[model samples]
Target: MAGSSFDNLPLEWIRAFEAAARMGSFTAAAVETGLTQSAISQRIGHLERRLGTRLFVRQARSIALTVEGDAWLPHVRTALESLRESSEALFGVARDRLTISASTSVIDLWITPRLDRLTQAIGGQITFRTMVLSTDAPHDDDTVRIRYGTGDWPQTYKQPLFSEVMAPVAAPALLHKDEAWQDLPRIAVSGPRPGWTEWCALTGTPTVPIPVLRFDTFASALAAARAGRGVLLASLPLCAADLSSGTLARIGDATLPHHATYWLIASKERLSRTQWGALSGALTLR
Candidate 1:
């Protein structure tokens, strides 16, 4: 076993090791891999023996990776991922239907507006899954994802949808009120986006009153602003239609730019070059 080569290692044993390490539980690994718990344990045991090293420290309720296991886990994951991607790219069935996962705000405000052009360009049917959290992982069947980030995901094809620019906006009726835009009530949205304080700092404006209404999701906040509840710090790209339709008016010329923005990412292994080109070309802002 001391001189055992990787060529002799079984794929099942490697899969078991990877699953157990990622899940930190032999039982959970079994569930994911559709194998019995004892089988997972046996495979991992054989793998450890073959490598002449203890991969995990067994505990009554949980397992923790040994130093050597932790060090090697990343390499193992990368190799397995490469193998899966290559197999899919070279031999997987091609489907005309694509599933995209994204936030409700992005779907309603950004993608929906471009749906017709996108559909015509890709020549496919599209399905949408609304993301509950921005940080949620892509679903197993999702072919594409619209994520809010700086375009730094690894091993995937990604492009920014638009530059991240934000400004204060209010319903036309709200803007017509005698009160100055700065004195109007503010709508606050909770998340990573910069808030009223950051806006004031960037614009060199004085501190404003606290928000009278706050919503956790951007969609809800945008709705409140559309109803003239308050002035909202809105993403210009997402609210472009609102601004164009006279549903919302910009408060001033000042805008805040951000390093992060919405990114359209696709599975490199799942999409062919032509499909990827059409999808990206149709959705990306010029």
Candidate 2:
């Protein structure tokens, strides 16, 4: 009897192969798939045998995908994605839980204040994952992400959360009435955003005082500014609440606009039209 082309091809074997290839380790794949290392290895072994080709070169400490495996990975991913999308479209249960991934500064300064409105708009339970680094990528389970970029992400529905306008800001206590705010100490935040150099260049100020305080995260710098530490180059949108409540005051009339800003993004396949609309509409700056 001749063997069928599709014989011995199982969903579990395919999943094991995909996970192991993507993660580059059977042990990691096992952790991701909630299986044991031996189970994952066995599944991949069975899959390789059924396909009559080696998918991985197993070394003592690591695994590398073979050329055939590398070539086939994208196709397998597409097929699995299609299956998942179709299944969700046809018979998926409506879930009220939503997960959002964003940097600590964004989560604290932007989302926290709008929680009530967001809850009302989405009508669901929301969970937030705080990203420590600006370069952190969203996990597969993160339904939505707030990222700082020029909004060029592929295969995702994205909208600018706000047009970032930067200006020097300081606590009222730090500035004496009728005194120039620029002469005070400067607080520097280290990141992609424009700093005192660009601000001074744009405003035609020859030079400003050197920064007395420096911090890596904007949130930390903002905290220092609020505590009367020094003048901070601040994103106006992020500090809107503070400005309104008099926690921080704009130093002058000058403002700097930048091309890159925070964007609200989500996978097109992960969100329905109504859900996407609700989420974006609720968050976008008016």
Candidate 3:
């Protein structure tokens, strides 16, 4: 069918078909769209009737896309995503709102408290939602993002927020209670690069091999350190509050270049509104 021909299809059927295609299961799509599985199947049936083709092939418990359906997925995804983006982009001009995706540590420790100040500086009542995303760029719903990485963020218009400094930190109790920090369990946070391996090189203590405790996020690792479990490699800006509030203390004067830096990124073609510009500025200022 031609591109314009899709407009002839019912909106409800199109929604069901796209959801089913993406999820590859009628039940999953139904759960997502708040429709019954039978309803989803009926809508897809309607869509298939309109197109005069099969969209899915039923397996034992799941559904698989037909060849045509497989080919159509990206196009449908792009079309729907673009429509949603445009709707949000043009949403209410005077009361524009922006949704941002970022890491949890950045949001909880940095942005949440400073959001009011950011709104005040931007001169609008712009609403925001900070979702934690796995990737560096904004996904299907979000238009703006703050990512932690090196200066070069993948395939997006990214502005440098700031580079992070890496150094060892521990709770005062942990350091005081244990004289064998070199042998005690050490907490590790995941990123491009982690641990005292590089930091030790900077401080000239490479042979120091402390037992490692791993956490997927810096917040958890910092929490472990604050709980007096062990020392953690702290990202300076991300742990400012902990350092300031005396919850954690530096293990030594050792420092090194962190592999990750905070970045404010957006899709170049997708971002054109004044609200986005104000949001971008607000992110860096805080």
In angstroms, give how far residue 94 of model 1 lies from its true place: 4.0
Name the lDDT of candidate 1. Answer: 0.86
Q: Over the stretch 149-223, how does candidate 1's per-residue lDDT look in tens digits? A: 778876357889999999999999988888778888999998877889999888876677789899988889999
What digit string (tens of lDDT, one per residue) describes model 3 on residues 186-208? 77766665567766666666445
Alpha-carbon shift of residue 106 in model 2 (angstroms)? 0.9
TM-score of each: 0.67, 0.66, 0.58
**Which stretches of model 1 miss by more than 4 angstroms?**
1-93, 136-138
RMSD to the native, candidate 3? 10.0
Residue 58 C-alpha lDDT in model 2: 93
RMSD of each: 6.7, 7.5, 10.0
**Model 2 weakest lDDT span, ten residues long:** 130-139
User: Can you give the lDDT of residue 237 in candidate 3?
Assistant: 75
For model 1, name the residue pairs that clash: none
Candidate 2 lDDT, 1-286, residue by residue in tens: 3677457589999999999988889999999889999999999998888888999999999999999999989999999888876876687665599898888898898888888889988787899998754675547888888888788776458989999999989999888756677678899988889988998889986566899899988889999999999899999999998899999999778899999999998886578756788888888845
